[model samples]
Target: METVLIEHFKKARRLFRILLVLALLCTVCIGIAYISIFLYAKIAGPPTLTVPQTAIFYSSNGKVLDELHNGQKRYWVPLESVSDNIKEATLAVEDKRFYDHNGFDIKRIGGAIVADIKAMSKVQGASTITQQYARNLFLEHDKTWTRKFQEALYTIRLEFNYDKDKIFEGYLNTIYYGHGAYGVEAASKTYFNKKAKDLTLSEASMLAGIPKGPTYYSPLLHEENAKERQRIILNLLVDQGKISQKEADKAFVTPLFYAKKAQDEANAKKQDASYFMSAALSQLTNELGITEAMIHSNGLRIYTTLDIDVQKKAEEAMNTVMNKDSDIQTAFVAMDPKTGAVKALIGGRDYKKSPFNRATQAVRQPGSTMKPFLYYAALADGFTESTAMQSEETTFTLDDGVSTYKPSNYNSYYANNPITLAQAIALSDNIYAVKTHLFIGEHRLVETAKSLGVSTPLKQVPSLALGTSPVRVIDMVNAYGIFANGGKEISPTFIKRIETAGGDMVYEAPQEKKQIVDKRLAFLTTHLMTGMFQKELNGYTTVTGKPILKYLSRDYAGKSGTTPTDSWMIGYTPQLVSGVWVGYDQGKQIERVEEKAYAKKMWALFMEDALEGKKKQAFKAPKGLVSVNINPETGDIATKSCSKKYKAYYLTGTQPTTYCRDKGVSEEKNQAPQKQKEQDGFFHRLRDWF
Candidate 1:
C-alpha cells in the first residue's frame, strides 16, 4: 500500500510539472502574438487622420460667404476651438474616465460585458472616446467580436500616435450627429443656432448627449425624449462634479431650440449663397478635373468672383419685389464687364425648395433683347446708324414655303415713315428690325450672336431679329458685355482663383481678349442704344434706356426683351453688366403687367444700389467714332434749319452729308447718277436693296 501511494504521488507531481511547462509556453506564444499586433499597430500609422472638412467659399473682397460639404456640414475647427463646457459634458456622459485610462476603461468594459450579456446583445458599449474614434476612423462599426477586436487594435494605434486632445477632438469631429451634422461645430450650429465655442453649458450638455442615439434624442422630432436625455446629461454632469446640483437644475429647465429653428436661421443667413456654392463646385470639379471625394478630402479653398455686397443687394432686391403670392420667379446675374467676373448671381427666388439654376440653365425667348445682335450684324455688314428702315406694314413669306407672317410694332403704332437704325433700336421697332434683318440676312445675325457669345442655336428667319431664339440669361449678359467692353468677346467666368487648403495656388483666370466685333461698330451701336438719353421732356429727365434709365440714370446701354412668357432686361456700363429675368421656373406666362415690369424694376433697383457710392462713369468711345447731330426726320447732317435733331454717334464717314431743307426734304448738291448714288447715303441703299 505504501509503495502504491508513493507511485501515485509521483505521477501527480509529474503531471503538475508538465502542465506548468505547457502554461509557460502558452504565455510566451501569447506574448509574441501581442507584440506582433503592437508592431503592426505602430507600423499602420494613425488610421487616416483626415476627416471630411467643410469647403469654404470666399467672395471677391475676401469674406467667408459659406462653408459647405457635399454630404455633411462638418467644420473641423481646432481642438481649442471647442468649448470646455462641451468637452466636460461629453466626457461626463460618454466616457467618464476618458482621460483616466490609456485607451480602454477596464471597469467600464466589465460592466458593459455583464449588461450586454444580460441583454443578449451589444446593447451596451464600453467604448472610450478613443475606441469610438478608432471605430469611426478606421474600422466598420459592427457589434460582432471580429470588429470589436479590430477596433481594439486601432484603439491602441490611436493612443500611441495621438495625445488626448487629438483623440478627443477627432472623436468629436468624426462622430455623427443627426440632421446631416457630422462634427461638434456643425452639431452645435445644427441644434442651437450658435458656434461650438459659444455654446452654453446647458446647450453643450444637451448636444453631448445627442450622439448616443441621434434619432432617439433629436429635439426636433422627439422633444420629450430629448428633454429626458437632457435631464440625464445634466445629472451626469453633476455626478462628474463638472457642475453643481443647482447648475443641473437650471440646465434642466433650459429652453432648447431644436434643429429646425437652427436650420431655418442658417438658411435665412445663407440666403442664395448655397446656390453659388453649388454652381462654383460644379465649375471647380470640371476645372480641376477632380472628383467630389477629392473636393471634400483634399480640402480645397474655392475663391470665387462673387461680390458679397452685390449678392446681398441682389437678394434684397428679389425679396423686395417677390413674395409668396407673386406667381413669377426671377433670375439675376451681374458680372464685371472688363474681366467677365460674375459678381452676383441669384438663380431663383428661393434656392432651398427649388435648386434649379435659372440664371445659367433655364433658356427662354429674349424678345427685343436679341435685337442688338441683329443690329450688330447689320453694322458689321456696313450698315450705319444713319441707315433708314421703314416701319410700315411688312410681310415676308416664310422660308418654309408654307407660311406668311406679318410683323408690326409693339403697340401697333408704326411711324409709317422712315426711321434711322439708331432710332429703330432705341424705340424697339420690330417692323424696322425685321426689315433690316431680312436686308442684312439672318445668317449674319447668327454669326454675330455666336461671336459675341450667344451660345444658344439661333434659327435663320426674319423673326430671329426679334429674339426668336431661346437664350440663357448668362448668354444675354455675356453677349451684351461685348458692347460694354469695346467689342472684345469675353466668356463670363465665376472662379477667380483656386487653391488647396494649404494655400497652394491651383488656378487663376487668364485675362483673355478676343476682338470679335469691330471697336467702331460696337461704339456706333452703343451710341445709338444710348439714344434713350437724348430725349428731353418738360422736366429735366434722362432720355436713355428702356425705362431702366429712370432708375439707372448713369450712362449705361441695354435692351428689354419680352417674349410671351419671359421678360429679360440685360444691360452694361463700362464697369458692370447685369441681366435680370422675371418668369416662372417652369414654362408659364407672366400675364400680369406688374409681374412683367418686375424684371425691369429689379434691374433698376439692383443697379441703383450696385452703382451707389461707386463713381458714376461714362463709356468712352473707341477711336474712329464721331458724335454728330443728325436729323431724325431725314437721317442727314443736322443744321439749325433742321427743327428736330438729336446728337447721334456714327461710324467715321458714315455721317449723313446732305443738308435738310424746307418741307422736311434733303438738299442734294448734284443730280447726275454717280452724284445721286453718292448722295443716296447708307440708309437709301439699305432701303432700296429690300
Candidate 2:
C-alpha cells in the first residue's frame, strides 16, 4: 500500500511540474507581446486626438441661433476648465486606480477575469480612462478579441505619449453622455443649462454617472435611475478620500434643475428657423468652396443677418393668418432694401412636413406684380405717367398676323374709355398693360426686369406684361429693393461673416452695389406703385390694395398680383422691402375669396409688426423730377375746380402743361390739348400701322 501511494504521488507531482512549465511559458509570451506593442507604439508616435466638434451660428443680435454637429454634440475644453468635482466623480465611478495604472488596472482586470471565468462568459469590462479614451478615439465599441487587441495597443500608445491630465481631458471630452451629447461641456449644458466648469458638486456627479450607461442614467429621461447612480458615485468619492462624508451627503440631497424640460416647453410651440439656417449654410459652403460636411466637422462660427424680432413677427403673422386645416403653402421674405440683408425668411408653413423652400426655390407666375417693371420700362422709353390708352376689351393681331391675342381685365370689368397710366396701374388694367407692352416692345420689359435684379428667365411675349413669367419670391423682393434703395441693385445677403473655432476670419461678405437703373426713373416708378392705395385713382374699379387700406398705418408703395393659382404681394418702404406668395404646392387654383386675399393682409400685418418700433421713413425723391397734382380722368394738370386729384411725379420734360376742364368751369374750355411731337416712337408707329 505504501508503494502504490508513492506512485500516485509521483504522478501528481509530474502533472504539477508540467502545468508550472506551461504557465511560465504563457507569462513570458505575454510579456514579450506587451513589450513589442509598447515599442511599436513609441515608434508610431501619438495619434491625432482632434475630433469633429460642434459649430455655432449667431444671429445679428449676438444671440446663439443654433448648433451644427456630425450627429453628435461635442464641445472640447481643457482639463484646467473642468470642475474638480466632476473629475473626482468620474474617476471614482469609472476607474479608481486611473492615476496609478500605466494604461490598464491589473487588480480590476484580475477581478473581472475571475468573475468572467466563474460565469463562463466575457460580460465584465475593466477599462481604465486611458484605454476607454483610446477605444473611443480609434475603435468601435464591439465586444470582440480583435477590438480588444487593437484597443490595448492604442491605450499603450496614449499612455506613453500623453500625460495623465491630457488623457483625462481627452477622455472627458470624447465620452458619450446621451441625448446626442458627447462631451462634458455639452452634457452639462444639456442637463443644467450651464457650462461644465460652472457645475456644482451635485450636477457634476449627475453628469459623471451618465457615461456608464447613457440611456439608463439620463437625468432628463430617467431621473430616479440617474440620481441613484449619482449617489453611488458620491459614495465612491467619499470612500476614495476625495471628499468628506458630510460633503457627499450634502451633495446627494441637493436639488437639480435641468434645461431639457424648459427647452422642450419653449419649443413645444415655436417657429423653427431651420429654413433660414439651411439657406445660410448653403451660402457659407458655396462662398468658402467647402462642403457641408466640412461645416459640420470644422467648428465654424457663422454670423448671419437674421433679425430675431422680424423673423418672429413674420412667423407670427403667417401662423395667425394662414388656414390651419388647409394644405396651401406660403412663402414670405423680408429684407433691408439699403443693404439687401434678408431679415426674415419663411420657406414653407412647416419644415418637417415639407422641407421645400418656396421662398428661394419656387418659381411661379407673378401675375400683376410684373406690371411695375413693365411700367418702369415704359417710363424709361418715353412713356409718361400721363400716357393714355383705351381700356376696352380688344384683340390685337400678333407679330404673326394669323395669331390674334385678346386680353381681359379682372372680372372682365373695364372703363371702355380712355384711361391714363396712373389710373390703369391702380386698377391693374390688363388691356391697358397689354397695349403698353405691345407699344413699348416686349423685350424692353424683360430688359427692365433683368436690370432690376430679377434672375428668373423672362420671354418677350405679350402675356409677359401681365407677369406670366415664373419668378422666385426672393428674387422679386430683391427687384423691388432696387426701387426702394434708389436704383442701387444688390444681391441678398444671408451671412455677414464667418470665422473658425479659434476666432480666425474665414470669410466676410463684400458689400456689392451697382447702379442698374436711373435714379429718377426708379423713384418715379416707386411713386407710381403707391397709387394702388390712392382712392383718387379709383376709376372703373377700386384700387387693388383697397382691401388692405384699413391696415395701413404709414405710407407704403406696394403691388398685389393674382393668377388663377398664385397670389403675390410685394411692397417696400424706404428702409425695408417684403414679399409674400400664397398658393397650393401643386398649382391648384385658389377658389375661396378669403384665400385670394391672404397675401395682401399677411403682408400688411407682418410689415406693421416688423416696423413697429422703428422710425417711419419717407421715399426721398431724386433730383430732376417734377411733382404735380393731376386729374386721373384726363391726365391733365389739376386745378381748384377738379373734384379729385393726387400728387404725381414725372421726369422734367414729361409733366403735362394743359389744365383739366371741369364740367362747371369754362376757363380752360378754349385750350386745345397739345399734340405730342411726331417722332419715330412706338406709339406713332403703331398708330400709323393700324
Candidate 3:
C-alpha cells in the first residue's frame, strides 16, 4: 500500500509541473504580444488630423467681417501658455501625478478600479496626461479593455519618444475646448481678444478646467459651473505645492471672466476697415486655392484698397443715423470711379439684425435714379440735349390693357408745352422719359443699360423708363460711375490681391476697363445733368429749410429717386461715385419730403465725410462739348432780354444754333413786341399781318 501511494504522489507532482510550465509559457507569449504592440505604437506615426478650412471675411481696410466654421472640433494647447493659474489648477484637479509619472499612475488606477467596481459604473478614468494625449491623437474615446490596452501601449511609446514638455504641449493642443475652440491660443483670442501668453492665473485656470468636459463647464455658457470647476482646480494646485493656499483663496474670490456673447464678438470684429476686405478675402480664398486655416496661422499682410479714414467716417455716419430709428435700414456704397475699387460700403444698420447685405445682396428698384442711364442712352442715339419734346401731362394705353398710364412729374405739374431734353432730365418728368423711351424703343434702352453694367434683367416696358427694374445698389453705383468715368465701364472689384500662405502671390485682380458708350455722348449727358445740383429745385435742400448745394462746394451732380418704398440718391464727383438707398426690409412705402429726407440725408452724410479734404475737381467734359448761356425753357441761346439766363451746356452735336428771339421770356408779350416780331422774321410777319 505504501509503495502504491508513493507512485501516485509522484504522478501528481509530474502533472503539477506540466501545468505550471504551460501557464508560464502562456504568460510569456502574452507579454511578447504586448511588447510588440508597444513597439509598433512607438514607431508608427499618428493618424492624420484633418482641419476644415474656416471661412474668414475682411472689410476693405483689413477688418474682419465674419468667420464661419463648419465643424465644432479644435485642438488642445499647453497649460502654461493657456494661463498660469489655469495650468496649476487643472493639474491639481486632473492627473495630480502628471509631472512625476512616466506614463501611468498605478495608485490612481487602483483607486479608480475600486471606485468603479463599487459603483458598478465606468465613472472613473485612469488616464494620465500622456495617455490621454495618446488616445486623443491615435485612438477613439472608448472605455473598452482593448482600447485601454492600446492606450497604455501608445502612452509608453509617447513617453519614450517625446520629451515631457513636448508631450504636455501635444496633450494640451490636441484636446477640444468648448465653443469650437481648439487650443489655448485660439481660446484666448476668441474669449479675451488676447493671446495665450497674456492670460492671468484665473483665466488660465478657467481654460484648463474646460477640457475635462468643455460643454459642462464653459465660461461663456454655464458660468456658475465653470466657476465651481475653477475652484476645484485652484484647490488642486494648492495641494500640489504649485501655489499657496492664500493665493488659491484669493483666486476663489475672484469673479469668473465671462466672455462676450457670440453675436457681440462678431459685431466687434466687424467695426474695422478690413471688414469688407475680409469678406473679399474669404471669397478669393475659395477661388484661389488658399485655405482659411492657412490664413489664420500664416500671419498674412494683406494690402487692400480701403481708405481707412473714409471707412471710419462711413461707419460712424451709419451708426449715428441707424441709432435714430429702428425701422429704417440704410445702405451706402462708394467706389473709386477711376479704378472701380470699392472704397466704403455699409450693408445695414447692424449685420446681426439682418445679415442680408442690401448693398450687395438686396435687389430693389432704383426708382427715378435710373433716369441718368436713359438720358445718356438718348444722347448717344442722336437726341440732342437741346432737342424739344412735348412735356404736357400725357397718358398712354399699354398693350396689357389693364389701365391708362399717365406719367407726371414728381410734383404732379407739367406744362402742356414743348420742353427740351435737358429740362426733361432736370425736372425728372416721368412722362417725358417714358415718351423718350417709346421714341427710342425699349430694346435700345435695354441695350444701353446693359452696356453700362446694368446686369439686372429689364422688362421691355415703358415703366422701365422710371427705373422699375430690380437692381443691386452696388451695380447701380457702378453704372453711374460709367458717366463719371467718361463712358468707360469698369466692373467693381473688392480684392486688390491675394497671396498664398507662404508669401507667394497667387492672384492679382486685373483692372480692366471697357468703353461701353461714346465719350462725346457721356460727356454731353454729364454736362447737362450737372445743372441739377446748381438749382434748389434739383433736390438739394436740408431738413432745416436750408440749401445743401453750398456745402458740397464742388461741381457734383446727382438725382433723387423714390418708388413706393425705396428712396435712392446716386451722385458722382470727378473722383468718387456713391449711391445711397434707404428703405425697409419688409418693403413699406415712405412719405416723400421736398428735401428728399431719407436718401438725401444718407447721401450727404457719406459724401460730406468721404470728400472732406479733397479738391473740388470738376467732371471732365469730353472734347467738343461746350457751355452756352440759353433760356432755361426753350434751351436756346439767351439774349439780353431773357428773364432767366441759365448757363445751358450741351454737346456740340446736340446744341441749338438759334438764339431765343424773345430772350429768356417764353411768351412774346413778356418781351418787347417789336423785338419779338423782328425775331419772327419777314415770313412770319407776312402771315401774322394777313
Top lDDT model: 2
Pitting candidate 1 against candidate 2, the one with the higher lDDT is 2
Writing each residue's lDDT as its tens digit, candidate 1 over 1-690 gives 999999999999999999999999999999999898788878887777887777777898897776668768776777788999888888888998888898989999899999998999988878799988888887776679999888888899988888899899998887888888888988987777688898888888888877988899887878788788888988888887888999999987878666676567766766467667677777778765757786776667778899989999988888886666875778888999878888999888767778988888888888998888888778777776767766678787777888987987765677777777767777778888888777777788888888888788889878888887888898789878888888886887888887876679878888888787788888777776676545621011223253555666687677788877888888778888898988876778788877878877788798889989888888787787777777765577677787667677766655566777642588764335553455465546765666
Against the unseen true structure, what C-alpha lDDT does each candidate score? 0.79, 0.88, 0.70
TM match of model 1 to true structure: 0.82
Give each model a TM-score.
0.82, 0.88, 0.72
lDDT of 2 by residue, 1-690 (tens): 999999999999999999999999999999998788878988999988988888888888888888898678888888888888888889989988888989989999999999999999987889899999998899999989999999988998899999998999999999999999988998888888888889899999999999889999998889899999999999999888999999999998999988998878867754478889878877777765757776787778889899888999999898888889989999999999988899999999999899999999899999999999999998888777777778898998998878988988999998988788898999999998998899888899999889877888999999999899899999999999988999997878898888887789988877877788899999988998998988999998999989999998888998999999999999999989999999999999999998998999999999988888889988889889989888887777888888778788878756766677682232333222342342225456645643
TM-score comparison, 2 vs 3, better candidate: 2
Q: Report lDDT (Cα) of residue 106, candidate 3.
A: 94
The C-alpha local distance difference test score for the whole of candidate 2 amounts to 0.88
Tens-digit lDDT track for model 3 on 504-604?
76567677777878887777777666666655223211112123464566677777788878888888887999888888888877654532466766676
Which pairs of residues collide in candidate 1?
Answer: 532-543, 532-544, 533-543, 533-544
Candidate 3: where is the Cα deviation over 4 Å?
Answer: 1-44, 52-56, 69-124, 134-167, 174-180, 190-193, 213-332, 336-363, 394-406, 415-417, 486-524, 536-551, 583-596, 613-616, 622-690
Candidate 3, residue 690: CA error in Å?
28
